[model samples]
Target: MCTWFYAEKATLSPIITKAQQLPLTDTIMNTMARSAAMSGNIRPTDMAAVFAPNKQGNIAVFPMIWGFTVDASPKPLINCRIETADRKPVWKDSWFRRRCVIPASWYYEWGIPPSEVGYHNA
Candidate 1:
């Protein structure tokens, strides 16, 4: 499960600033630049940066709440197994209707144990 990830503020700002030059994307990109300077570890339910298109069709980069609620478990869904998404009613409609891109500079792997801490690798 991709429970934790990171975003690079250094490169992200400049990139967004440049991309904002395109028509219809200036406002959203500028907004993203103002608050996108987030670095270090991000956990489930935290506000993390994601890139997605709004109803207007302009690409928007903003911080959104991670994970979605599910009735099967008390914990929020932080990951999805793509292969079975079509058969799952909870994720089917969303998987088909919505599209999102999660930007992460790095991700952590916990091969040792669930409780033990793990380090982020490039």
Candidate 2:
């Protein structure tokens, strides 16, 4: 049920570049800053840091779209329950092979109780 999160370029690049053992370049830094998504209500085309193996064995941080594309629909599925993923066909392969970690400073939640309405820590 996660629909929002906070991300900062400062954290994302290092997490990826370090994992892949890459030096930070000015171009990538600029791209990270420009594309930084620091909000929870992200859409399908939004980018996030995901890990993938490069030619070498080390994992590299890669920019990936938020969710899978759905045929004949504009909106995509952003969240799924992990408990049932193994039994679901759509996520079975990804659950086993394409597992990843998302670098988030925090997350946002709505409709919480009066004292916790605006935001919550991740």
Which candidate number would show the highest TM-score if scored against the true structure?
1
For model 2, how many clashes? 2
lDDT of 2 by residue, 34-96 (tens): 344423444345656666766686776765656765565677776678799888887787888
- At residue 56, what lDDT does model 1 achieve? 92
What CA root-mean-square deviation does each model show from the true structure? Answer: 7.2, 6.3
lDDT of 1 by residue, 44-102 (tens): 65555667887798887655655777778887776678898877888998888776787
Clash count for each candidate, listed in order shown: 0, 2
Off by over 4 Å in 2: 10-13, 16-43, 55-57, 111-122
Give the least accurate 10-residue stretch of model 2, judged by summed lDDT: 111-120
Candidate 2's TM-score: 0.58
TM-score of each: 0.63, 0.58
Using lDDT, give the best candidate's number: 1
lDDT of 1: 0.59
